[model samples]
Target: MTISWLYIGIFLVVSLGLPAVAIILAGILAPKKPSPEKSIIYECGVDTHGETWVQFKAQYYLIGLVFLIFDIETVFLYPWAVAFDRLGLFAVLEGLLFIGILTGGLVYAWKKGAFEWA
Candidate 1:
């Protein structure tokens, strides 16, 4: 147990320390140069005219999250489907339950106007 903990501790330290050391090294080794052109926000090689920080509608993110959730359903379902013959009745019920829950979530999102474009 102690050895396992020691390994975990070492792993954590190395994982964290490596990135920190790299960033510190970069800061120390990189050139200290600043200019107006460098500071200004450049988009598609053109100067930005309006405010850079534009607020996006929450619906965009909500729709994206919905897509992500459904997409992940395929990942879980595909394997279960491939092995359906071996898995028998229990797996079928479990898969049905999972689909039912996701369907309920989709219906809820639809009712909330998450699919609306405008």
Candidate 2:
């Protein structure tokens, strides 16, 4: 029991210590040059000409999040579908429940105009 804890403690220390040591070494060894050009906003190796703090459409973010949520559903669904024969009635009902919840979310998002481009 104590040996298990010792191994865990050593693992945790090494995991944390490595990153901390790397960061400290980088800070000490890295260059400390500072200039106005360096401070300027860079985009794809091109100098930004205008306002950098432009606001984007919230609808774009909403649509993207909706897509991501539905995409992740396939990760959960694929295995369930593949093993449906072995899963029996309870698993079928559970899968249906998961789908029902997702459908409800889709309906809500649809009603809220999340699919709209404008």
lDDT of each: 0.92, 0.92
Question: What tens digits encode model 1's per-residue C-alpha lDDT throughout 38-102?
Answer: 98766878877777789989888998899999998869999898998998798799999999999
Q: List residue ranges in candidate 1 displaced over 4 A.
A: 1-48
Determine which window of 10 residues in candidate 2 has minimal summed lDDT. Answer: 41-50
Give per-residue CA lDDT, model 2, range 27-83, as digits (tens).
Answer: 999998989989876687887777778998898889889999999996899999999
Spell out the clash pairs found in candidate 2. Answer: none
Report per-prediction Cα RMSD to one decimal: 5.7, 5.8
Which lDDT value does model 1 have at 39? 87
